[model samples]
Target: MPPARPPSRTPPDGPPSAPLRALVSWALYDWANSGFAALVQTFVFAAYFARAVAGNETLGTAWWGNMMGVAGLVIGLGGPVLGAVADHTGRRKPWLAVFTTLCIAATALLWFVRPDPAFVLPALVLAGIGTIGSEYAMIFYNSMLPDLAERTRIGRWSGWGWGLGYAGGLVLLVLALYGLVRAPGWFGIPHHDALNVRAVMPLTALWYLVFCLPLFLFTPDTPSARVPLSRAVAGAAARLRGSLRDLRNHRHIALFLLARMFYNDGLTTMFAFGGIYAAATFGMDSSEVIVFGIGLNVTAGLGAAAFAWLDDRLGSRRTILLSLMGLVVPGTAILLVKSKTLFWIFGLAIGIFVGPVQASSRSWLAHAAPAEVRTEMFGLMALSGKLTSFLGPFLVGWLTLATNSQRLGMSAVIGLLAVGLAGMLFVPEATAHGREQDRA
Candidate 1:
């Protein structure tokens, strides 16, 4: 076996001189997957899967939620191990390619999931597997960010990615809405037929595959470590054991992870449930839901673009704190308002904060971590976020199921945000870019 390199104490030099293509490629993952989130998670698939594809609509949502929760657990538990392999092997692109193809193929196979009750379990299982693959791939992608943007400018670049992703999602959702949802008559299909919704599944697969091409073509792969795959796997297992032991040694980072876990739970819950609430409370039909999804994406894109500079200039910590507060207030307000007008108002509020939270959290972790261990750091970040990601959906599902009230379930989100904010407050300023060394 080759000698293990000493843990890198200093960050590699200030970010790369020019990593524009790398930045674009990193953002493209977001772009590629946003279609899945928008069309499958938000609008078309969930509706179709539950109402048309499952034996029971209400029960299917619960099962779908369970599948998502299981996917998150798999990702959270497995991410660090895979990321360590990437760190040791010193190649991220090949792994990315493998997972990306997995996601694309799984999404494409959804084309077969017609209005058959027997297909529910199998379809959700495929989707869960895709979710796991896409999420695991993201760990490697996030680890590359520090190489692509300067220390102070990372947040801006991250925001750029968030904007690009939303843009891609918006484009495809528009196509699905206009071409399939609105014009079924031209295709000699009924307006609310299963075929109309079925069309979106394959289109989402195509969208994800097409947009992912830029990243594969442009982004340079991390250097290979010259280790065989088997040895790399063994080394990664050893290092992960050591890293878990070392976790207690890094108290501040541990605390930060815990905090992020809870807050991210709130943020994720909002994403998972926001549309359901609108549809349930205000009675938004499919077209209105599509329009709402479009508006959210547009506003979210603008919010990311607008806040990118603010994140860099002010620092990631403040940006996250501000975003958490912004999210909390408006999110709670959604429950109070009875009218659809007010729901849109609250949704716009959500759009404003959601982009920054998503973008700045990434920058914040990059700033906090030592350079050589960036992949490990990002992997842990993904793990923490994913582990907690299940809490929101589980909580929402349970509460909604028990109370038959969306409003009651949403209250839990407020508590989650508060805990995340408080935990962040205790995190050292250095981690938040309060010190000059951190800025470097």
Candidate 2:
């Protein structure tokens, strides 16, 4: 198609299967930072921000959504450009390291965000930094899919990564529940002080640092290109424009990213607000929310492991289609159900499908991306995902504030998911077997 390009990275030369050590190391990166996802984004900090910081559940939820929307906007704008630079330089690890450090540092700084209205602006700023950093780092991590597994096996590996991430999240959630929520004063931090909750921020940062080490040490990334940063950016922009002009050959991939963008926006909005949703809607406390997070993580971990195998067998596109539909049913159900028990049930459904949807989406792109531009393509994928990313959260915020009904506000996600599902009808699966045949 395009000219033959060099490998994205100078990974070890071997058989089609990646070495066990390398694979595990790669997957552990997911494990490393999941604490941030569960603790900061989904479970603890988000709820705390809404209730404790913002001072009112409804307004707090709206503010939290607005903060995430802003971060998504910046990420959407910058992800592709940064990804192109990485591809051109042939060095993803350095950029990843920089962003990971930012994520960890910003997350740690969140420990200082207190209940005063004076702290809300600073808290939002730090949270936005962490969110954008985490998101940008993932583009490079996701690009590794092409290097880590052969086309036939990428889905399973992607699933393995996600499952382990959820497992990690579950472990951290349990620990936080034990040390902070359940016991209240187990760590010598008074319950009234709420240091128990704030302390978890630094711990999550440390956990991310420790687990991420294996990847930095063991997983070899591309060697740096000698090109200057300015030239790399210019070159990347030119290539992207050329690719856009050649959309006929890339139509299916284009559709998939477009579909992924909308669906992921809905999914992100659901996740960003889930903890706040439960707290406001059901009056669930910290302990109950932690339990919910644990259960969902457990279900998602198991589902990720199971669906990974299914992805290869069913075809990545089919697997993703099933996962998207799976999300739609429960996502809508959340709007209907009032009981905490029913919310838990539907939340588990969301968990079951979320892993597969993510894993297969990546594998689908990895299958089609030329080796030369893997990082760039994944960045574009990230871009698409972040482009309308603000829409779901923004809509949720607006409706929640206007109608003063959080549940009714969440219904907005269903519309996004349904449109994405419709878009999939045009996304023809470009089979891996055909590519293998071409290679022969």
What's each prediction's TM-score?
0.91, 0.94
Shift in Å, residue 222, candidate 2: 2.2
* Candidate 2: tens digits of C-alpha lDDT, residues 35-146: 8889999899999888888888888888888999999999998898888778888888888899999999999999898877788898899999999999999999988767
Q: Tens digit of lDDT per residue, candidate 1, span 1-440?
A: 43374354334544553466767777888889788778877666766675667755446656666777778888888888888888877878888888878887887788778788888877888788778877777888777777666676777888988888888888887888887777653345455546776777788989888888888888776677787888877887787777667767766667778889989878766665565566666777666787888998998888888888988888777888888888888888887888889989888878878888888888777777766566876788878888867777787777767887778877878889989999887665433332223111
Off by over 4 Å in 1: 1-11, 55-57, 185-193, 430-440
For every model shown, the clashing-pair count is 0, 0
Considering only N, C-alpha and C atoms within 3 Å, which residue pairs clash in candidate 1? none
lDDT, candidates in the order shown: 0.76, 0.84
lDDT of 2 at 221: 73
